[model samples]
Target chain A: MSPRDPSPGAVGLGRRRFLKTATAAGISMALAPLRSAYGQAGAPGDAINVALVGLGAQGRVLMDAMLKIPGVRFVAVCDIWPYARTYGQRYLKKNGFEVRAYENHQDMLEKERDVHAVIVASPDFWHAPITNDCLRAGHHVYCEKMMSNTIEGARSMVRTMKETGKLLQIGHQRRSNPRYLVARNRLLGEAHLLGRITAVNGQWNRAVSADLGWPNHTAMTPELLQRYGFADMHQFRNWRWFKKYGGGPLSDLGAHQIDIFNWFLDTTPSTVIGSGGRDYYEGHEWLDNAMVIYEYRLPDGMARAFYQVQTTTSAGGGYFEQFMGTEGTLRMSENPKYTTINREAAAPPWDPWVSRHFLAPQKAPAKSDDDSSGGSEKVDARETAELAGYYLPVILTKAIHQPHLENFFNAVRGKGALNCPADEAFKSEMAVFKAIEAVESRSLVTCQPSDFTA
Target chain B: MTESTNTQSDCGPTLGVLLLRAWLGVRAVLTGIEKFSDTRTLQVPLLDAAGKPDSSGAVVEVTQKFYSLHSYHAIPDSMKDKFAQEPLLPSLLTTSYYAVLGWALIALGIAVLLGLWTRASLFLMGLLYVSLTVGLILIKQDAGVAWLAIHVALIAVALSLCRHNRFTLTRS
Candidate 1:
């Protein structure tokens, strides 16, 4: 018999007790820093033994980050196809790292019992099951984002993370990047720099590209391919476009920006409405282009945010999130090149902010002498302010992945909390999947507090 | 608006400090460019004892300019003997390393010249100069002390002027 999707019920209850448990876990770890926190076997030189499940694209990126970091050792790698495993193993071996390779994750997990953590980089559908099995086996996990393809499966991850009390870091690496931390914690949280953020806009636009490809390798037997639910190499390579395996571009790409929208706002969106279809890719199960709008009810009043994901062309711009407030607007992107903070012309001057080093000041572009509006048109005293655009400082300079990987490894070693924990990531899943549902239902979907109730 | 002026004023680095920033930034640019393109500047003080801008002076790489006082020919036989004994003679001179350092100098120089993230730019540049001093010390090079002293003084001036970074492209 073929394996079916695991039951979400296997992991029970997502009560509010996580905070208390997490706090207790923190205190206990603080008490004993040298030892492992999750009652697992420790590694020599304080290095953590990490096993990876999928050696796909992101999996390789994580492996590269691991190679750079001092403490992470790749003990085992598992992949259904031979290419990923062979490439990863050869690359690591060349780098003087010795690791065992496996075709089945269960075998990898069983053989590498000493592994302190597991990084699940499989397809969306396998996220929950693999994470669930790892958590049950007492290994900490750093699963990539989109906790699972379905909300139910996503919820199961949250439940298992809570029940097992093991650290489950979802790969929203942005949360761990110091730039985002400073923007969220220092600028928005402490300084309230973008005073009373009233609206937000986000988008991730990707230029059209060729469908995913596989290296020229001897094909696996038909049964071997079917065992993993792939009918052919094309489906295996391009699984993200299939409905049965993954959410379309919205969940694939929009989840990250949508997660930021939810995060920077500090509230779960109350309503979502979106629309799109595979207008370009006729056979694609997921929408090649999607636009989702979310309404967030903030403490000050109701706030709204809009998000769009397009695969046709990146003509407009790349991915970024902009939070607009009465005083100014803060725009951030992973690329330091695009990040900027623009001030409202009429709003209170940002001198104090600049003085406090809360913001880096940029000069408004010099107006051309041919400018029409510089006239001394003594307009009304109250309405004299005009908006001017100036850029904010860009401080990020290092590779982006290293910081988050450090966070996860450090969290495992009792240093700090996971920057993007499962509970936090599931919040984004609700927003993203519901937005996908919104596109299908073609109506405004109201989200209740219970939607995030786990 | 007081906001506009104060915001501008916040970036008000002093004239002396700005000059220092520009000098260091331009030095980094030149140094970075000489790494791959000109590289002939390392022999200026040797071929032209007046330290005039000969092709050698125009092409000195960061390490060669800061160390190995002689052009490879100018080094005395005694020091050349020490060079043979020493292991790993400053590996930061790689092509990729120079390229990145050049781009960084250009970026930081532009940032300081514009008063954009002035503190970080000045702090990093100062830090880099100090690090170069340390690297020179590690390699037992008596050279670079004068440039280090000037850079150290500039770093101090940068700190003093950083709090008031006005008359530049960016602030704070």
Candidate 2:
């Protein structure tokens, strides 16, 4: 008999047959969700009526994420500019949502009084006012962060949320990212994987781009621009660079990462020192490049974080926050490709974590034969081998912003708690305010504990 | 007749052909077998000081390689995605090629080993290596392309020397 033939009366199934069945089962199991969604409606009585108050680029990003969530009905769309207003209305209509379009947010508020939640994605200056009004109107608010251009406006947002007893979720989306949560709650909090983080380095660098311009036919009159606190159509279209309407590159781009520093460190910085200048962009009101160092007082020791935002060059390895500790280093970013963990040579074995499936070991890259620049090996006698990298083994399959929006909408349904609540966000926003102050003063700015309190 | 057969077997070219067949045939069979083999690392939970099984603490054991039909299709999703994007290679064609590749390698490898139609088997094996080289080139894997180029060259040498092949299931 051939080796391939089964013995007589063999009780177990052949390996090939077993594998074929398993493969079929896996494919069927994977497709089950899509099949069921097509056959039925969303969860009963989970309807959430949401109104969007800003229809610009950021607003559209939030809308796209919200569209993927089930049981969310768009009741109204509002923007100050007619072009954005029309674009939002048309886009939502294509997505099967016939929403009321208004050029004034207050007009939409008055008409759509019953919207369960309002997403405030307006310019930084308007975040506090719109969020406060939405809270007062009995709507939960999801406001984008750098919460406001000024500290007082951000404080008012916290005060209003407390007074009105509404959930105010600030859009620091990393707090709700699955990969970040695992790194923070499990690896850092539970396992003590990185053993007393000593320092952090982060940056967001962008190559120079032209000033934003609008279609001449779609330009709003100067009177309307002035009414909305913009100097002219130039300031309105490019509000992010103007001081009156928004913060500079540091506040606009740096806030997202600086907030992560505070959250992961679990403490606000005590001092900030930095310098910045607008040497590159000719007409922009804010600094074109800024570098700031923030010092945090952890319970065990002191930790310092260095952060920079550069609008002129995309040089220093894209955007990521790297935390260096005695035992290891963790580099994290919104992009999963940038997230990685590295062990220090002196640290204890991470074999237990690997066995627990908390980490996946990375295979070393193959050495190239012709790479022969060999001076470093002869110069250092006691040099250690470079540490291997390990992945966190956590994956976020959904769009990055979707989970944060879902967290807010779920909290509105009384099923979950807000990830970045208004009070918590106020504390982080204080650090960003101080960093900008440091840049302007070109000196160290110290913070009092009470200063961060809402 | 027996003396003639003995002389043919002991000749230098016949011995060279025998050694080459042994090396290539073993390599081909093992490569085919590996396509249907896989390994998994499993964690056996460790007990804490209080005698509870700690999910975070465990002993890792790498399982012995086991063969199954599913293992044959364990190509990485990323590679499959790249292949799907290549304009010249349709996904269906790639899929069909992969489905038959392992079995073909094993069958041809056995035929070459037993000296059953040795010349024909060597030529077919060379074609298989050429096809693999094409895939490696499409993926821009320079190292893999180089490795397969060596295999194709060796197969060409083996074909040139296979006229002296003996000790076969069929006379050649």
Candidate 3:
């Protein structure tokens, strides 16, 4: 007798298969709108293809961070340095990723048709060419900071992205940091908390020196060196010290603080006046200590922002922002602590009973003026003033980097607008550019939007 | 029999000779353009307070002019500087020579691509390459000089490959 034909459920196979298939189909249907909204969303459970062009310090850190996110696969990597290529490949392989690698970016762009996005962390000189090629090849991009070494390169990059209708997210991580977001919100949203902010001060100080003996050698060949505006290996490796490859401290460190200043003021500075030079460090082409004063005119009035960055000295504590106002002052930083201090009262107290009793109260026989009532009044005033003088608010935030990454991925999926778009980056770049100009010219430099245009 | 033999042996112009002439012609035209183009008059944004163009704007204007002449596209207005600084005649002449050389090169590139004036165009392009390369090197504009070097090398290779004036005005 044929074994009684097992029922579908009893067979433990047909029903389960049907359920699995149904679930997948349902998910695809549910995610259809999301896929349409976001420009590109890979299939469910499919790895998203990505490539990293630069494997420098920051580039490696970004790769580690991207690996933490699910559904990502590093498909290809490119760097002019052979070591960077092998390093990236080994890291990916150790993490179970099968990545093809290329020494040249053009070749990678040509070969990697399935690549959905690319992360560019190459030197400033290569940013424009790599980014333009990536966009033209129809891939989204996450480029590292200081979009390009030159304004022309930056303009060309922006133009290429616009023409190609591609997405580019600059590597300004503070825009993604939750602590900075909280501080930004408090400064802009709580109008009276810091009174009317009339001035701001920002400082970023470090203890780097030319004598530190850091590897200041570049690996470019003589031919390449001549072609790319580098005088030599030292100039290329320590590009931050030169005007050709970088904007020095103003572009390196000042960019972050300047962005914060713009965030707080809700407006860009109309003009920037700057002074300071390479007073401390020797053998460096860029300024070791510099200060820039930016005057931002808001709808209410004008405000001043002073930025001081020093690389030689270690004496540093004000590594934050101080907002000054008529009524109080607010000091804040990314450390999650915000403090405010109210102004002291300008007038002294007067006795109320003297007017009612007589023009002047006759001296009471032997009773002192410092009685309990007067003393209590003084104590109360003191307590009130003390309470009003300072308020410290500590904000608690979960990691913001993950959320920022999530936002970028979501934007790729068409879920939201970019937190920091190219236009905003252009503004930030312009501010930094003007700061450098001011330092170079030794005078005030006005920043118009047109200054950044091609 | 002797007369017929002589007529049969008579050799007209060889392909090598024809190619050399075509190359020379292309070179002359490119050199003329390089000598005649008015690049200094080009305008650019980022003018200094005194109304003179800033360094960045000036460099961009010059580069754009060079590329425009190379690609045969019209120069855009944003590049026009209102404050006309005094012309550097020597520099202007050098720039015009490069411009004409660019057109000539483009014409040669087309001729070579079409196999029309292959040998002559290749030769002319090669000569233009040498002059431009020398000028760029002397000017000490490192970036421009590097690119010019590459172009010169490429033109040299193309010129060497012309067999029998395969494409030349003579052949056309």
Candidate 4:
């Protein structure tokens, strides 16, 4: 067979089958409002002490978000890069926090006993190990998603979290965003906007971009690169493109959106079929574009969701997900600009929904197909029915990452439940890995219940 | 000879109407899909289910910036704050107007081609064009004002002719 053909025969028979052992699916949020927790980290006025591991791009973003949360305080920062280490310390000191700096995470863990929690923003390869170490050291961990590059690594984190009894919240930040909480919990879960959701579709199309560059002032020595399994500075900075260090673009990008598929459906996929190629970017280990379909068996019938991420062009639009059902479709992006609930023609009148606070009572769409009124001509009802879609407001004004971090800190203090906890995050990991497998294999991969179990 | 003569005479307009219907039908369907698929209307930085925009939405952001960049160039220096916001309210209003207009054109063309309620389709096409003309004239922009008037005139003529058409899905 040609190397171009992608077909996964079995999990243990080949590397594709080996992926079957990987962990995680679904984002079953414990529906409870958070109470202020974590006064124990400091006095009533003092912020809870937190340390950060992996001073990469996501690490920096998380640090900024952590600073914004009222109760959390950055106490230590660690990275393999000497410049990054000092940069973290300097940045924190500039912000009035006396942060301890460490070139190694183990050193940070051993030294910073006062830290109440740790945020693991390491590359995909290191997520499990670093998060596990932090949990072992008695600090709650908020690790970034796609739990690890490997399902085994992801599963190990879940096992470690379970063993330690520490709060291990995975960084699927959408779980924490209030607008999504309203969309998912209030609208879908409570009100059932998209009644009996039968299908889902989503895409994340990014414009062409150059290879990522590292910000460290000094390049890593060949020995250091060898130690970290990187070929050079480029590989270190762009670890996401590598097979060993990252889950490529599929696990990196698709993990976020597919988790929503699992979130809205409240079920792990039974099968995933995908097709993709590295057509756009050359010399990358990961595919540049991947399209995957996941089959989720609902109680009444089978529902399907299609997810695609293309790095070559942003021709059509930005990333958004739509849940379609018998009644209506609820589509939302991060911005309020695209969030809306569109009713189907056969769906019930939406005005009653307004009283339920699910929809904003706007004009009942003056341009309906029903009445030619006194003198004007009437349009067809079906076409005008599409116009009756309602837009939601920009209700959540806080930056996106803040709420998840807040939830993690709150969970650490025993005040709130973890939204994207290890068990839930792992389902997404399994689903993501399965999709990546299907794309590479060029075959329909059936997911057994065993596939989701670690 | 009589049957053959009658058949030849009837075939001409029937084929013409069918051909015309296909042309208008395909054009309307494709344009409707285009409107539904337009990048600006799609809205994003495709966020995570958790509502994070890490994946997409840069196109909208860049376009918004471009709008602001142009407005900053054209507007008075005294109103720099208002101008800096870019894609001002007028532009937003114009976008909404065009979105609705795209849908109506699509609906009008499809209904007319399919002969689905001829009177309503022709009237709607005319109403849409007239509304668009008024909106464009209100904006006072030279860019597409002339085209809007042409559309209005063409729709007006089509509406008048539609009054006498015998071929339709539903007869008056």
Candidate 5:
């Protein structure tokens, strides 16, 4: 049948209408608040006073994204390092923003009373404290992910937000990515194109790299390092690999993609088994490579997802999540090139979706040499046609983190709901926390459903 | 055998030349035609669960291929962007070249097919291939350069056997 033809049956027609309605609803629901948030031109009363708490690498990234958003003004910048403080202050000033700089977040809060929202881009160890303090100080917060270095710390941030009745958004930016939203909500959730998903695999691998270095002239004094909970500048700069400051690669990289497993499945893992080692880099306290397997007990049937984060080599197809089912598979990544959907030969035809322009079929495979040469060859009875892939017809042209930050800002303005609220991210973080535990104990860690609750 | 049949069989080189002319002419014409093609999305009414067109005004986007002046200009403008930064290529020259490239390909392709000034058409086609090779080489596109080289080679063979040309737009 031609692509424009409606499906032959009532059920198919029902699905088509439902797909259209749901897609339209989802787009309006997602776009309406964002449009309101972005349309404001920073007029006097509409402007939101904002503060940045950490001016390091992640802090600079968040600052750049927030700068593009409308109706937000930076009033203060804070960081323990004078080097970063200078960078953030200068960068913002160049963008027509002049803000006070401080070496401490509390000091900034005390001086900048009008600040409406604070962005916590500090290290994992400091995320909870900074976010909690900002919330208690009557300011909404947008904190970077791996919510906190510890489960108790993550829970405290959630509890504090509840007590203060403030907005707390976690930086799982993929949660707000339009491409991901369409794939998860429309294709998988509404269309049910991937049939019964039974298995998943994901990875984030990196090539070996040397530790970060700092300018000798900008180095902090020993006394300053001691007060800020760092052994030295090395510990402060390379905090992600240390035990006291971070949860290693699993929390640093795995948290982003693993959170999607929970979000897409709408359930936390029941058990986590892990294996890892800190073998590559010397003086680093955390594992260099970690592999984890999480088992989910859904209402229908059990499913499993395997995840890994390796800092030694980027050999395995960059980073992406693959969901395999009887009908099809979805390979998703923040990188658009790594994302696609493939349908099994046994699955029903997807002409309706193609007709609706929801999915675009890729080029068909060339005929095999045996068939082309007209040679008589017996085909194996078990052989099936190759799975054909379709490209998701969506793309994100802006900075990857911009949408999530916009979502946070909109929530702060009471115009929209937080995409990655503290409570929801806390649940996903529990899986990573347990996977880390499984790594330490070298055993499978079983988690009760209650374990995910903050 | 009949005299007409003998005449046809004796001119094997003419048949070879005809085959090459047809292949090149069709390829060029089709490539030019595709430059005018583009995909446009339109919202169409959706069918409800009962397989009847919905009255709720709900619609889904349907993309269809269209031929228009906008696509013809846009395709060349896109190619100009790719060639913009090549040190050996000037922006003005690239722009002018692209403006006429599609039409020139179609006209030349037809002239060769109809044996209208076949010698001049084949020579200009070869020159076009040569210019494309230079552009591809400057952009460090090895595969495109190789493909253009093969086209130039075919044109060279066709020109060498123009003596066997039997068809023309006017009497010989």
Candidate 6:
């Protein structure tokens, strides 16, 4: 397909419409009174003034949440795009905030003296530079996920964060998610619920068409091409398809799943082995679908874990994790649902002890009044409450991001530890780095401690 | 009257056949270079396991400097190791080979698009692609698989048009 194809135009139009609707809603929300805001008041000594760099889609969402967060004020906004800058300014103005605006983050940091925290929501390539500047400037940071575009960049961020003694929270919000937290507590914390985890399976699958909004065969200027990270701006915008700027699905979506595996298992994979390519999509450079497998060994050496992620024609919406253990299996996802299937405690048919134990008194199995034929069983309120409480604040509540931001603010106030620190982010990034290497090499890629060094 | 009209139409060529003939004529004109140039030979530096140039670190250093000037995915460590073992060309020469090949491919792709020397460019690209693919396969490198696929596809398209040389102008 040529670069000038109309499909991208159609997609862009759809996106623009969505953005228009979102922008209108944001304007209305901003105009609402501060007293009625989600979070409007702060405790004594809890004041946190924040400056946002890169007011893109995710950036605006975080900003909206911050405005609603009590004790937090939006002090400054920065963006390379004029539209984003104007939208952010309007939102802030409506919220009664005299937000200082800048075309660049460096200028914003230099000018905004009262800013206690900076949020780095720029592109993958810009994360390290912006984060380093923010840390060195003595401001706590809440940088978005996929910490950096490269392994070296992630390492440097970690080192700089450590040297500055400032709070640096990596935005892997799933770490703060109540559903995942409950799953973690049940599978990892409770031993009997799922006996010594032997293996883990996880997947995040989605279906997307091949068109990315841009003209095919578009003549690219040297400067424009360089800015886009390639001679093809079409590939640049649809970066997941290219190798220069993005690492395809392995780095984009796989990072989250890998982070979950690492978090629950308390170990990074010993090695990652996988293969993927753009098999279905014609004329696209990036892989449309991929499958990866990672082998992890727990510190105790008692269990092994495996993780996989695929993005292709979706047979169905898939986002779940299965933990296989000796006694029972636990399946969980962000849907706030988990199942524990208990296996009967008995000797195997092949075991010699089965013959010997057969003569012993065989107690009748316990019976329940509830229907057993149906697979679905009602969970007691107390059990559900325990699972829900596993996540900080509560489950089934839209406060995950709020509490995560709250944690960052508390860390800045020296009252709490960061939920996802730079070191942890580096570890997560290392896993992603290995995954990319593994896919490229078609061989198992291992991560050593030295790999984390800047 | 109908018979006379059919006879006249048969005597005169259709636009589709005329275009095909013209395309074949152009393809025949550009194939002259393939007969003269020896394009089968492949040249690449040998590297050892550590990815250091086999002969010395000089080639590796030169390659690194060249890469710094024009950024490409860093040569995989495995490729470096292969270079160390084969050492087909010195580091400077190897770097020059890449520079020349990259420019040549770009030129050829443009030429093919313009239907200027289409056959010659396609043959040259095909040879380069084949040589590179063989070298990578021999060295057990996975880096160039995508490029190999693209080169093969382009060569097939160019070869399929060998019967026609009538070039279509952008406006025409």
* Top lDDT hit: 5
The CAPRI category of model 4 is incorrect
- Name the top DockQ candidate: 5
TM-scores of the models, in the given order?
Answer: 0.68, 0.71, 0.56, 0.65, 0.70, 0.55
Highest TM-score scorer = 2
* Residue B54 accuracy (lDDT) in model 1: 26
Give lDDT tens digits, candidate 1, residues A185-239.
6578866777788889988888888888766765676788788877777778888
What fraction of the real A-B contacts shows up in model 2? 0.00
DockQ, candidate 5, vs. native dimer: 0.09
Better of 2 and 3 by TM-score: 2
- Model 4 lDDT tens row, A207-264: 8889977656587787776665567888888889889789877788778889888897
DockQ metric for all predictions:
0.02, 0.05, 0.00, 0.02, 0.09, 0.00
Candidate 5 CAPRI level? incorrect
A best-first ranking of the candidates according to their TM-score comes to 2, 5, 1, 4, 3, 6
The local distance difference test score of each candidate is 0.74, 0.80, 0.62, 0.70, 0.81, 0.60
lDDT of 4 at A195: 74
lDDT per residue as tens, model 3, B1-172: 9998765544233444445444544554454454334434222232333556432121111122343333442222221121122143365664465345445655665565556655565666667667655544553446666876766665565555444334444553
Regions of model 6 farther than 4 Å from truth: A1-44, A190-192, A210-236, A282-284, A299-304, A315-317, A337-394, A452-454, B1-172
Model 2 global lDDT (CA atoms, 0 to 1): 0.80
Off by over 4 Å in 2: A1-44, A372-384, B1-32, B38-172
lDDT of 5 at A377: 43
Model 6 - which docking category?
Answer: incorrect
lDDT digits (tens) for residues A291-318 of candidate 2: 9999999997999999999989955688
Order of models, best lDDT first: 5, 2, 1, 4, 3, 6
Better of 4 and 6 by TM-score: 4
TM-score of 5: 0.70
